[model samples]
Target: MKKVAFIFPGQGSQKIGMGKDFFENSDIAKDMISKASERLGINFEKLLFEENDKIGQTEYTQPAILLVSSIANAIFKETSNIKPEFVLGHSLGEFSALVSAGAIDYLDALELVHKRGKFMNDACAGSGAGMMALVGLDDEKVETLCKEQREKGLKVWPANYNMDGQLVLAGLKADLESLIDTFKEAGAKRAIVLDMSVASHCELLQSAVENLRPYLEEFLIDSFEVDVISNVTAKAYNTKEEAIDLLSEQLINPVKYKHSIASKDEDVDAFIEFGNGIVLKGLNRKITKKPTLNVSDMTSLKKTIEALNE
Candidate 1:
């Protein structure tokens, strides 16, 4: 049997009109959007389709992206025979993965992500914290560079180990600036700052993690039917307790994505990036030379279905 995995993208992958295709064509998509609007008490549809880039703030973007991703996953389940053997998500996308795997209900996931976005936004307010991507550098070299910078009063650290030559760093604005020259001096191809407001996956998010603890404790999570990989530890989480704990700790812990992707079982025949963009597909290519598909729209979904059947 050929195994398939569903991968979900995180915050930076969100764009206006992400799920608009599915919303117009699929009843499930419409219902999911409507429910998200009612639960969050905000016009999620309007934010997704009408707001353009203005609503890309943390509070709105997190839930909006997750909602779009979940709808996409639902569409696949309803329309195709392609069942996922394993599911994984990047950063905030992990919530979507859990929902798709039947570990958490859609409403609970929506509310949790909404609250999580608010917590993250609150923690980052007035901190001058941000993220930057460093290209063409190995993980060890980047870690060493960040440590050296930290010794010089820079708070920078490896935040996302995205792929072989790509890593995201998070810390105070000044700290990032301080490392720019060093990054270039170390032969980095590019060291560009991302527009993210928070220094996520770093100690700066400890306050947000603390705020999220209560919600995790209160939510009723059950064991997942499908294997869901954890971003915090880069391993499969089987029990409800482990899932809840990983969800809470993910806020402040660095994403072990490299290990997670590298550890995927050899039985995986193809990888499908379930929503938004080709980010995960790109990362998958770095880890293994496998065929990867990206399904963010109806056309892509049809193509993927045909390809899988072939």
Candidate 2:
């Protein structure tokens, strides 16, 4: 039997019609998505199944993505007896991971991420802030650039350490533009600006972290049912309090995903992305060279279950 590790993707992985396949085919998925729609008070299915600009807006986007990802997981669980030995999510996907571990109720997670999206969006309002992916730079160089820029009073920092030579930087829009040419000169293969205006996972969201802390505290999180890794520390979460702390800090700290993937690579036989896109599967291939598959929709889910049954 394969030792599977289910990894969930974060924002940027969400897209129109992401969960429609599973929702249409499985009563299990339909029920969960329907309940989320009622609890969140929005036609989340329409928001996800149809093309709309609101799907891109942070407040609406967060909750919508969570609903789909959670339902996808539920379908996979109901149909197959093969369970993941470990689970982890990237950035916003951590909330989904918490749900998979039975640490947080799915309804609470839906509400939490919706509020989190609002907090982050409000923080970025009029700040002229955003993020960029700088490929071909190592951690030391990226950290040095951030430190030097901060010394010069620029609001820039490494927001995500996805893998070696791939760092996502976030900060004031002006500061990001200033580094483009310099990064190109430093032999970066790409210094692409992300479409998002929100400077997520950086100090710019420090206030958002503080504001979201109390909301997290109100959750009745149980002890984790399965090991779920943390994005901020790139380590396994040991306690409910620790998971909650990191979720808040995740808004303001760099995502240590390279280390997280590396930490688990030797333990699992296969890596599977359970949500919207192939983003996590791609990352696992780039970082760990592991066998990875994505079950984003119904077809992929059937294929994966067959492979597991074999």
Candidate 3:
């Protein structure tokens, strides 16, 4: 079997018709979506398939994304014999990774992340929370600039190390907006504050870390059936003990995504992203030379299986 890593996408990947192909074609997908809606007391069919505003809300967005990604992974597993060398996910996607690895059940993950998103939203509510994407700046430069801003009592901090010259920042909205010109002047080709209400993966989320821990404890299994690389440390973890700590800390730590992929690139012949979009696949193109295949729907799923089989 060809060695590969399975990856999942996080927030910013959700859309109106993410899992429709699976829902329309596969009974398995239909059942999973139905169960998720019942478990969460939210109509996932409307949230995932129809046009609505709640789908973008973080609490709803979390479970919806997980459900679709889980369905995609589940359907792929049914048809493909290839197993991953390891698994990893970005931000909210980490819980989906846990579900795929058998460290947590998919229903439990949906509930956990729904609460996780609520906690995150609650933690940052009214804090003027926001995020920014900075392109064309190196890590050290961005870190130094953020440190300088923080020394002046600003709330900005590096939030995501997506790839070389692409870093994201999280903090108060005004603070991030204030730095746009500063970042641009400092060699960032583009620096724009995202229209986000939650400041993720930074000290702004400290309260969320504690709020999310109990759920992690309650939902996670004893150990992983397949090792998952952590977004916090960019390292492999298997047991619930490690998962609890890393996953909680993940709330307040910048995702080391570029590091995680680059460090493990050679171990896998390719990557298969199970989700609604090619977001991670796009990132992998810049992070590693290894090809990334995605199973977002029936068409892509078949294509990915064929590619792997070849």
Best by lDDT: 3
> What does candidate 1's lDDT look like per residue over 1-310, in tens digits?
4578888899889888789999999999899999889988989888988856646888888888888889888889888867887899999889889888898888888888888988987888899999999998898999998888778877898999888888999999778977788898898999998877788888888888888888876654776788899998888886788887888888877888777878885758888888887888878887877788878989999998888888
TM-score of each: 0.96, 0.97, 0.99
Q: What pairs collide in candidate 1?
A: none
Candidate order by decreasing TM-score: 3, 2, 1
lDDT of 3 by residue, 47-96 (tens): 88889999888999999999999999999999988889999998888888
Alpha-carbon runs more than 4 Å astray in model 1: 52-54
- How many clashes does each candidate structure show, in the order listed? 0, 0, 0
Model 2 lDDT tens row, 7-97: 8878888789888888888888788888888998988878988879999998888888778788878888888887778888888888888
TM-score, candidate 1, is: 0.96
**Candidate 2: worst 10 consecutive residues by lDDT?**
219-228
Q: How well does candidate 2 match the true structure in TM-score terms?
A: 0.97
Off by over 4 Å in 3: none
Give the root-mean-square deviation of each candidate in angstroms. 1.4, 1.2, 0.7
**Which sections of candidate 2 miss by over 4 Å?**
none
Any residue pairs clashing in model 2, and if so which? none
- How does each model score on lDDT? 0.85, 0.86, 0.93
lDDT score for residue 199 of model 1:
88
